[model samples]
Target: MSLSEKVKERFRRMFSDVFFKRYILGLWMMAEGLVYDMFDEKLHVIKTLPDTFDRIFAGGDYGINNPTAFLLIGQKANDFYVIREYYYDSRKHGRQKTVSKYVEDFQSFIGNDQPENLFLYPSAAALILELREKGIKYVRGADNTVIDGIQLVSNLLSNKGGRLFAG
Candidate 1:
């Protein structure tokens, strides 16, 4: 079936169940452009990205207490997909995680699959250096313009009929 039909059916199914009324109402609010101005729940499902994507990229945002995130993204044409992530809060570790430790996890996360591009937040410069020192070259700084990036991602998630999932 077509995507629009799928969306309509999905909503209808949700609306049919009284227990899901609140969630469906929220979806209506979003469909009317009244809520989640940057969210695209369609792309948040558990599914795989298309094989047309040729490049894999990884990016990191570092934080000692706050959750530090590393996303592995796949890109095809001008579209993007979030394939996987390594999200952690050092507080959960019971102590602040060192840059070396984060790098070690990052290495294990990527495994033998070296990404074509690696972007790191400025705060992760030490981790970037450590990665390079470990001979895992190919790192760059991510241009993390929140508003602009959100707008772009929202647009892509709406227009591109593809799947992206991360855990």
Candidate 2:
């Protein structure tokens, strides 16, 4: 099949495996929006601990102890989610280096050629500014109303068993 078809099939399989089995919830509303479309009484919400206390409570040997940031891409009108969670290593890494790594990762994932039909949250503006300094192009976050609209569309499509983009 074509490359686009392959990508769609991969996304379908990943989403089904990762998201279909559970309802997504988060401490912040933005994260909540990531999987809110699938919310159901049977769904389990992963408890979110406060950032400050979470680390303290985690004790030693809990791996990285920092507030991780996420990068999410959702199709406009369709609302299919591709979320990337990134962590900061203040002790050994700087923000610019972290941003550069993320940009590289994003470019590798989506390719150098930009797609016209994509939406991204702008909370990463500082990172985006860094990207702009390095000559990358990207958009910012949508308003809450827009997110709600997309969520509604996503829920309807999911309920109807309508795949966002099939292979």
Candidate 3:
């Protein structure tokens, strides 16, 4: 199975549980930093997990403070949604070693059947350029409308505004 297929499979398995269904819904919003909570008559927007995850996952490569979460967002062969995420611990290796490990993990997850349409939301320009150099086909997720749509979905999830996966 392709990476996208694997991700969709995982989602299906996880989403079957009520707890995970709620958790994933919450995570979608947390990923986009769109949740607001009331405190002392004041409303505050919560910081999304992606911002922190991106920070820890990008730049300097070693130590527990390093980036641990890597998310792969795209579409699967069956036209189902695909979102895969993995984590790495910098405490186990040096900077170079950890980076290499991440690259290897990324490559393995991607597999050989390269998707004609893949997108990445890299945290840094250097990483983006590096991926380009490696000849991986991708588009910048920052300015992409698809990403914006995901963000909107995330917001709806965070607010607990409606049901998901329901017609």
RMSD of each: 7.6, 17.5, 16.4
lDDT tens digits by residue: candidate 2, 20-74: 4442221223333355444433332223312221110000010123433433333
Q: Which stretches of candidate 1 lie over 4 Å from their true place?
A: 1-43, 160-167
> How many clashes in each structure?
0, 1, 2
Query: Tens digits of per-residue lDDT for model 3 on 1-167?
Result: 33577776777676533334346444332223323221111112222212211111111122235555544433222122223455665555454333445556666665643444434444445555655566754535443456675666555444344311110
Cα TM-score per model: 0.68, 0.38, 0.39
Best by TM-score: 1
In order, candidate lDDTs are 0.70, 0.41, 0.41
Number of the top lDDT candidate? 1
Could you tell me the TM-score of candidate 3? 0.39
Ranking by TM-score: 1, 3, 2
Clashing pairs in 2: 122-141
Q: After superposition, how far is residue 127 of candidate 1 from its true place, in Å?
A: 1.4
